[model samples]
Every structure is written in structure tokens, then in C-alpha cells.
Target: MEKTTNLQETVHSPKDEGGTTLGLSLDKAWAPKTEEKAETEAGNDSTGDAPEENHDYVTGYKLALLLASVTTFFFLQMLDMSIISTAIPQITSDFHSLPDIGWYSGAYQLTSATLQPLTGRFYTRVRAKWVFLFFFFIFEVGSLICAVSKSSVMFIIGRAVAGLGGSGLQNGGLTVIAGAVPLESRPFYMAFMMAFGQLGLIVGPLIGGVFTQYVTWRWCFYINLPLGGVAGLFLALLHAPDQIKKPQVSFSLLRKVIPQLDLLGFAIFAPCAVMFLLALQFGSSDYPWNSSTVIGLFVGAGVAFPIFLYWEHRQGAEAMIPLSMVRQRYVWVSSIQFASLTTSVFVGGQFFPIYFQSVKGVGPTLSGVYMLPGILSGLLFVLISGSLATKVGYLLPWALFAGAGTAVSAGLISTWGPDTSTAKWVGYQILYGVRGCGLQAGVITLQNVLPPAQGALGIAFLIFCQNISTAVFSVVGNTIFTQSLVKQITALAPSVSPAAALAAGGSAEAVRALAPPGSPELAGVIQAFANSFDTVCYLLIAAASLSFVASWGFGWIDVRKKPEPGKGDV
Candidate 1:
């Protein structure tokens, strides 16, 4: 039976002395102690650093189970994001809709990027366990829809729904750690979790290739059902410690949900992103950059941008990007670093596989193999960075090293040619990924600076920037790749229409069939693919360079040096 107690979760800014919480649930043994929070807050100093009592880390057997469960889901979530890469060409062939290819990836990112901040807020207000499971179920349902999709439209809808659900997993996972893990030891667990999550990115292509070539393209989505079920079971068994907020429940909590989550601000903000990204899509494809449709979308995004900002300003602390919290130097700067690094990473994600398949003439299965050097190197460094950060008591150096190192690597990558030796390509990937330390740059900095009360929202905002960067830059890369292909094919293979050569049915095997090796058409098409990747890599260089600049903002602050139990530290 539902209790008649008050049910409120008051999320306050860092400057607030202490947060208030109210809930309507049967008294549970593990619920956060309200009295302990007030006592700790009264004893804490001016910097708003969390007291020792506030670091309620779940330890021993529960910690092990929690980490394992989180790792499993992280793998599934990333697998869901990436498995489609190798299978997209076949998927397009089955549905006979080349124009819809962008939607397959874009729709997922759209819902993910736009909706995550509110999900972050939800984490703060409600029971995080329930919220995490809710999104997990949503993700499973979306995957089921995709597996059964018979038309391109159905697949696109499924992708959008999956994006909405999968958006919460990564952010939610990090939020769990920030709340439950002590600051003194947060880096290792955070980094370890992230390192494990990245494993999915490495093997995703191989699994997708095996499924698509040996079975059916639908198996790519089908794999998630079984894996996600296992992860969900594990997540259910563990009682993950969360932020010290009263448990929210009952019909009153339902009534307060809209305002609590800032749905109105999201309504204004989501359209801005949709319209802006649509403009990029339209201008990049058959439509000219100057086309009326593209211009209108751009103008609409422009107008909405200011309106959204103004709305957030009016909403203050509850807004998607809280003005007071983000205004802090460390939070804003780290966000920039995160966006640039994530953009650079995704630029490679979007275009490098194309570099292997189309330019090198490697088949889908082999192309995945070729991308491994980078993924492995990146994964290795994530673990190393985490351990080093924990041991050395500094995070800025790693962030700076990754930022500076990746700029040099991305610059090197932009120079590849169609006949570039295997040695150069593999080395470039290692060079790019050796800077994997960049992955930990943004979130660790955030967890250190924000109060525990703002933990979920801060993480949500940081990832919101990253999701937006990846989504926007993916469209930008597609624009570069498509436009460059059109221009190069026209100039180099004037007799071969770019449309036919770039078609789903016309890729790889068709190119070899229509224009055998040593033929002028084959040479032109391969060179076009080579030149297109080089253009896209320039964007990668720019993004990496910007990340390097943002890295300087991390400064020399020691992440592990928490203040005395009653003292403030900033």
C-alpha cells in the first residue's frame, strides 16, 4: 500500500547549504538518511565539497556485482550504437531507400541528444534504479521493433525510439558512480567503467559483419534482446546507492513530473536541434546549400536558439543547462573539451570505415578487422589513464596529453591516399587512439567540481554537449563525404554518373563489376573515396585541435584532493 507521506525531491544549486527531500514510500532500510545530510551540510565549509558521510559508496560484493552489471549494459548500449555500421549498406539494399540512410543514424542521435538532460533531471528527482530500468525496457522494446522492421520507415521509427532509451544508459551509469563512489577513488572506477564500455565499439563491426554476411542483417538488432536481458537481470539484483534524495512516489509525484523535468524547455530546445541538423542534411545532399528549404530550416533554428536560451534563463536552476551550475569555470571548460574530443572520435567513427571498404577495396568483414588497431589502442589507454589519474592525483595532464596528441594524429590522418601502405593506415589509427585518455577528460572534471546534489544534471549536461557534437558532426562529415564524392566522380570519371556509383546496390561489388581494377572508372571511384576521406579528416583535425585548446582550461587542479571533513575545497 502507498504511504501518505510527502513526496518531493528538491535539487538545489551548489551554493545552497543543503537540499530538501520528501517522499511517499514504505520505509526501506537502504533509503538515504535525511538527518545525516543536514548534519553533514551544517559541518561543511564554503566550497560546497561533499563531506565524508556524503560519499556513501556501495562496497564489497555489491560493488563487484554493480560494476559487472554496468559493464554488461554499457557493452550492449554501445553495441547497439555501432553494430549498424557494417550492416547499413545491406539494410539500405533491402529497403531500397538510399535517402533514408542518414535517418538510421540521425534519428537515434536526435532523440538521444535532445532528451538526455531531462533524463538527468529525472535521475535527481526519482529513484534512479527505477528510472534506469525504465529506459532499459524502452531500449529493449525499440530493438525488438527494429529487428522486425519490414520497411525503411519502420526501421527509422524504431531507431528513434531506441535512441530515446539508450540515451540514458551511459549518462545514468556515470551518475551512479558520482553519487555512490568517493571522490578520492572516483577516477579509477569511472575510467574502468568507461574502458570496458569502449570494448563494444571495437567488436561491434565484427559481430555485425558476421551476422550480416552469414545470417541476416536483422540479427544485428536481434543480438541485443538476449544480451540486454542478462544485463537487466544483473542490474535488478543489486541495490545501487544513489544521491541522497527522498524517494519520490504516488500520484502527486506524477502531477509534478512535467515541471520537475522541464518538459517545456525541452519542447523549445529539441526543435532547434532538429531544424539545425535538418538544414545540414538538406544542404549536404542533392539540394544546394543556398536552397530555400535549407535556408528556412537554418533561420528557424537560429530564431529558436535564442528563445531556448531565454527560456532556460527564466527557468534558472531547473533548466536543461542550468545557468548557475554551468557558469562555473571548470564545468563549462570541461564541457567544451568533451564536445571536441567526442566529435573527433565520431568523425573517425563516421568516415574511417568508409576509408577501408571503398578506398582500400576491403570487404565488410575485413574492414572491421582493419579498424581494430585504433580501437585496441584507445581501450588500452583508457585503463592506463584511469589508474594514472588515481595514482598521480591529477587529471589535467591526461586531458592535455590526449588533446595535444590527438591534434597531431588527426593531422597525420588527413594525408592518406588510395594506395597508402597498410603500415601508414594502421599507425595513424594507433596514433589517433593512443590519445584515448581524452575520453575521461570531461566527466571526471565535472564529478570533482559539482556538489553531489547536482551530480546527475552535470553529467547529463556534459553528455548532452557530446551527443550534440557527434550528431551535428556526423551530418557534417556526411556532407563532406557526399559532396566531395559528387565533385570528384564528375571531374575524374565524367562518363560514370555519381548517383549510380554511390547507390546502395552500386557500392563495392558493383563498382568492381562495372569497372574492374585497372579500368579508368574503378580508378576514378576509388580515388574519389580516398579524396573524400581526406576531406573528412580535415574536420577531424580541426576538432582535435579545438580539444587541445579546451584542455588548457582543465588547469592543474588535483582531482583527488578533497578538503578536510568540515572544510571547503575548490
Candidate 2:
């Protein structure tokens, strides 16, 4: 065990030169040193620690302010993603394009997911601040387009554009925090950022429901204009630590990296994602399991995935994903946990409103109101868990608790009958709120474990997993809903076919038209939905259990130890 004193001297001397000094100091001098441990565990390989020069400097308060702004931007971006779900029914009716309604959500998700890796590269090459501002403008433009959109195509286009900007904003929020904040202070700032994002999630549905019921769905898009303007303005005005040095764009670098980008990998990856999402959304309704489209999609994803893996390994250093990172026990396990947690959230998001509208007979606005408890719970937990993590320096127990709580809450909520009491329902929502707190805390823990230089890349990879998992699980949950509904409806009404029942657009109006007044068929529909919800909850529970395993895999890393005098933070 050894203690270092390099930081004290560097802190006192302020220099305008290109080099910036960072030092780490440990309070407990007897703890086993990082260098000694690394030597014993692996070898004497240098960890690429180099002194940073001409570093961009910003005040801590200013950095915090900038973090807040970016977090708000992220909140708005995600709000637009989920807020529209409740309003889709109304939007489709007004536009008279029910058939193409899925596009509204799909377009945003597909484009955003596809561009995520590219954005990670872009951040490395370009000034993040200007890049963020550009995206902000694009987001505003997309919102304006949606606000005035006269047709479904126009709205889809607008959503696509918004998705592009949102992809950047979401990634930028994490990247900026990683770049600007010291490792120790990051948890606190991350908590604040995540809280803002949860606030947006809570508000988005409620706002969307209100606008859809009272005003128009267009307002959902219109509202972003003013909010985004304010956020972007603040960010543009603020100064933060700049990590990107001047663009060192080199043809040689590109030549070395271009093959690693793996265009073939994307060709396979993109279609697999799109097809799989389509299978979930349209399966059993528009296409059967044996149908050519569904079969083709599943088979394509199956075949392409292995090829992508082989290419990734072969490309090695130049690969889009560093295989070493993927191979790390901590990294892969954390990523799996992250993916599972995201799946749980996505599944819940999809079905909770259905329960409110279809079973509880609540309007869209009230459904959003029902979601409030979960959102608030998540907000509170994110704050507390973050602070706790900072103080205690351990994240496993909290993550396990969150996973278990989420599973239990989902299971309980799945038991709701058509006549379930509102008080009981609210209790389940509270459990969901607790779940939110744990999820964000676990994410921060994963980020904290990585070296600071890889922080942004780690966050980006986690987000990539989240996006892919959400898309895939959302599709699976939808499939469960459709399959259960068809089976239940067919059993209750032998004369009516599944296709005929679904043809009415899965709306309450169509269900009423198909079932006679006070018939057993209506009860069957309710039962079918109950079964579907239960199945999804069970899946979430399984994921939560996996999260527990992943949480336990976290290894110890000391953040307080300072590097040698010449060794840089990076």
C-alpha cells in the first residue's frame, strides 16, 4: 500500500500552457496500490496514461450548468419518443392513415438506432459543442415540420429528422459529462442528469395525453420549439471543458479504420433490427409466423449476426467495436444487465397504457396520470442511489434491490382484473418508481468502473445495447399481446376469425362492433390482455434476475489514487 502527493502541487500552479495536470490522492494510505495490483493480475503493460496538454478549462459551476442543459436536452429527446404512444390513436384518426401509424414511432427508433455508432465516431472527430448545437437546430426544425404537417408522410419525415437530432442529444449528454467532470464528482452530476431525463419521461406522456385530448397531437411537436430553444441557448452560452483537440483527420487513419466500420456489418445489422421490430409490431396481425416476411426477417437476423461477429474479431484494432472491451467480463455482463433493464422498461411502457385504457377503461390522460407514481419514484431513487454510490463506493446491492423490486412490481401489476381498485393500482405504480431509481444507479456504476478515457465509449456502448434491447423486447411484447388477443377472441367467438377481429384496428370501437352487447366475448378479450400482461411481466422478472447476476460481477476499482507526476489522467 502506498500514498501519492502529486495532486497538491499541480492544483496550486495554474498554467496557460498546453499541458494540464491532474493528480489523485487516497485518504487511506494502506490500501493495496493500483500499480502493484495490476502487475500481479496481468503484466507490466503501460495503461496509456499521458499528461493532457492545452486542455479546455471551465469552472466547476459552469460545467454543472452545462451538464444540466444537456440533461434537459436528453429529457426532451426521450419525451418525444414515448409521449406519442398514447396519442397515436388520435393522430391516426385525424390523418386517416391508420395503416401507416406505426411508421410514426418506427421511423424515429430505426434512424436513431442506426446512426448511434456513427455519432460516437463523429464526437471524437468534431467539436462536441458545435455538433450538439447543430443537432439542436435540426431537432427544432423537425418539431416545426411536425407541427405543420398536413399528412402522414410529412409527419413521419419530421419524426425521422427529430430522431436524428435526438440520437445526438442523448449520446452527447453522457459524452459531455464524461469529458468535463472528474471521476469522483461524476456520480453526483450523473444523478442530476438522469433525474432530468426521468422528469421528461414522466411529463411526456401526461403532456401528450392532455394535448391529444384537449388540443391536438401537433402540439406535442410544437411544444419542443420553445423548450429546445431555451436549452440550446443556455448550452451555446456556457463554457465547458473541451476534450476534442483540433481535428486530426488523416487519410491514413481513415484507411486503417474504414474497414473496421464494416459496412457489411451494418447491412446485416440494420435489416435485422428493422425486420425484428416489424415482426413484433406486425406479427399475428399483418403476418403469421410462417409468413414469408416474418420468416425472412428472423432468418436474416439469425444468419447475419454470426458473420458480423467474425468480422468484428478479424478487424481487431480498426473494428467499430473494440473486441477487447466486449470480451471483458465486467463489460459484457454490465451490458447484458443494461439490456435487460431497458427491456423491462420498454415492455412496461408498451403495456401499462393498454391496461389503463382497455381494462381499467381510463382515458389517455388518466393513463398518463397513472404513470406518475412510477416516474416520481424513479426520479427520487436516481438522486438517492447516486449519492449513496458516491459515499459507499459499491453498487451491487442497490442494483439487485432495484431488479427484484421491478420484478415483484411487474408481477403484482399483472394481476389486475377489470375491477381492480385504484388504490391497489397506485401501489404497484410506486414499486415501478423504486425500480427507476435502481436502473439509473446501476448504469452509473458501470460507467464509474471504467477508466475515464473510455468513459464516453463505455456509455455509448451501454446505450447501444439499451436501444437494441428496447427495440427487440418491444416487438416481443407486442407479439405476446397480439397472439394472446387472437387466441382469446377466437375461443370466445368461434364464428369470427382472428383476422376479422384484428381488421377493426385493435381499437375499442372495433372490439365493440365485433362482440355483441354483454357477450362472453368481451370478457375473453379482457382475459387475453391479462394473460399477455402477465407473460410480459414474467419476462421482465427473468431479466431482473439476470441483472442480479450481472451486478455481482462488478470488480473493485479505486478512484482516489493519484497517478505519478508525469502520468496524465487519460
lDDT over C-alpha atoms for residue 517 of model 1? 67
lDDT leader: 1
Runs of candidate 1 exceeding 4 Å displacement = 1-55, 96-99, 248-251, 505-507, 561-570
lDDT of 1: 0.74
All candidates' lDDT scores?
A: 0.74, 0.63
Q: List the residue pairs that clash in candidate 1.
A: 8-22
Clashes of each: 1, 6
Instruction: Provide the clash count, candidate 2.
Output: 6
Per-residue accuracy of model 2 over 6-119 as CA lDDT, tens digit each: 211221222225554211122221123432332221211234332132245555678767877888788888687668766765675566544454456656665666666556
TM-score of 2: 0.80
lDDT of 2: 0.63
Model 1 earns a TM-score of 0.87
List TM-score per model, in order: 0.87, 0.80
- lDDT at 56, model 2: 54
lDDT of 2 at 369: 91
lDDT of 1 by residue, 1-570 (tens): 221110121111122144422211112211244323322332223343333323357888888888888878888887887677777766766776555666778778878898878887777766576778789888888999999998988998999899899778888888776656667678899888889888888888888777877898788899989888888898887777775543445567656564566788889988998889888777866578899999999999999999998998787665767776677666788888988898888767766666776677766677778878888999999999988886776666788888887888888888998888889989988988867887887788777655556667778888888888887887787777777878998988787877765664313564554465688877887887788779988888888888888887766556664334334544
